[model samples]
Target: MTNINDNHVDDHSNIISRIGKCIKQWFIQDFDQNSGELDAAFKNNMLVVATLIVAVTFQTGINPPGGAWQDTKVEPGGHEAGKAILASLHLPYNLFLILNTLAFSMSTQIILMLVYNKKLYFEVVVATVSMVATYGMAVWSLSPDKDVKLRYVFMAALFPYVWRLSFQTFKTFFINYPTK
Candidate 1:
């Protein structure tokens, strides 16, 4: 009984130590262990993630779910040409648009961050701006509802900025705030 109790305590201690080590490792920023340099692999992985997100969001924006209206109709209960059929659903469509835009914006931000220190940063910024513009155009053109179009465009264009600003404000106030 005594031996079993001792072994159990030792096992708990080992587990705790392992947990602590894992926490430390996770918190460590991506740096080459030997040279203390930023890991290229980390940057590459981030860039790939960002690019893929942009591509998916762009494709979804252009194609949308349920496709576009086949023909234009000015009558009541009819959809216009080049408008997303999903937009007619209201709530689900709005939710999808918001989430997709959020992903797109955050991914673009990541891309900017990764390339901010690069030599061709200006060119990359221009390309990202163009991509953003294209995405906005896609969203604006595909969404049919006149009332919803502005809202969708605004959300797609500005939600990421709002999100980043809100995040930074919260981080500054709550995270980096001095605790006396």
Candidate 2:
């Protein structure tokens, strides 16, 4: 009971499958060429990024752009302080606080993932987003001009997300090729 229509469908499916197989094979060969070196490189690279992210988050959260708040008030000559420093310009205090928290949280998670030996390829994505958000918060809070268009900053932020997705896709394509 062979339907002629089924043959056409199978033929099309076979072609698609072959194309996919070729792509998979290419990536595998590329990885094989490097043996386990790529995996080590990726891990090392991720470690570096995570470290930087943690540092950035820590610094931003602790010092912030405005500075830490001090209770001592100066009589028009001494500097006043609060939980955070006073900005020469308007400060998006609330926004920075939230972003700083998120960045720190994500950084902590990355460290946990490393310790647990678990990989969802989440390090780059979460870290990148956290870092970008922290940066945007800084730009938003510290910049004196509120009228400044943030389209460029927004676009720059998007790059990390895009790069993360692209990297994970490639890494997943190789899958368990190697890790040394």
Candidate 3:
């Protein structure tokens, strides 16, 4: 019985160690550009998916959940015209804005990555900036609270860059560092 219990313990430890390695490998997996697998068709498919994401996110930004305020009001708990009705709820509205902005940012990044032509790339970048600005304005006009809205928009927009920086830092210090 004692020997059987020891084997069970060893099996559990081995399973846990394997799971840990798999999780680490998943995070550290790199996109091998020269692997001869990422061809033009794959790039085109990715671009189409990214473009769809951009469109969906843009639509949501313009027409947020809970709709918009129609008339101006001065009383407490009352909102101005053109503001979002969901703004009053605070938490859900903030989550919705942040997630939507993050989706928009990531989709735009994918589009930028896939475009090879210089002129087209430049045009996409300009359009991306314009879309971001329009989204910001839509959020601004819709949200009643000034401080929180700006924070959410900027944080969500920069999250992809921040995420990449963090991953690079981890890969450098932990994954690529001398293991000996």
lDDT for each residue of candidate 1 in 112-168, tens digit (9 for 90 to 100): 878876899999999999988888888877876454646665666577677667655
Error of 3 at 155 (Å): 1.4
Query: Lowest summed lDDT over 10 consecutive residues: which window, candidate 3?
Result: 28-37
Span of 10 residues, lowest total lDDT, candidate 2: 82-91
Model 3 clash pairs are none
lDDT of 3 by residue, 51-159 (tens): 9999999889889987898898889777888888887787878888899999998888778767846467888889888988898788777787643566867899899
Q: Go through the candidates in order and give the C-alpha RMSD of each one to the true structure.
A: 6.4, 11.3, 4.1
Residue pairs in clash, model 1: none
Off by over 4 Å in 1: 1-38, 147-149, 163-180
Best by TM-score: 3
Better of 1 and 2 by lDDT: 1
Alpha carbon lDDT of each predicted model: 0.76, 0.56, 0.79
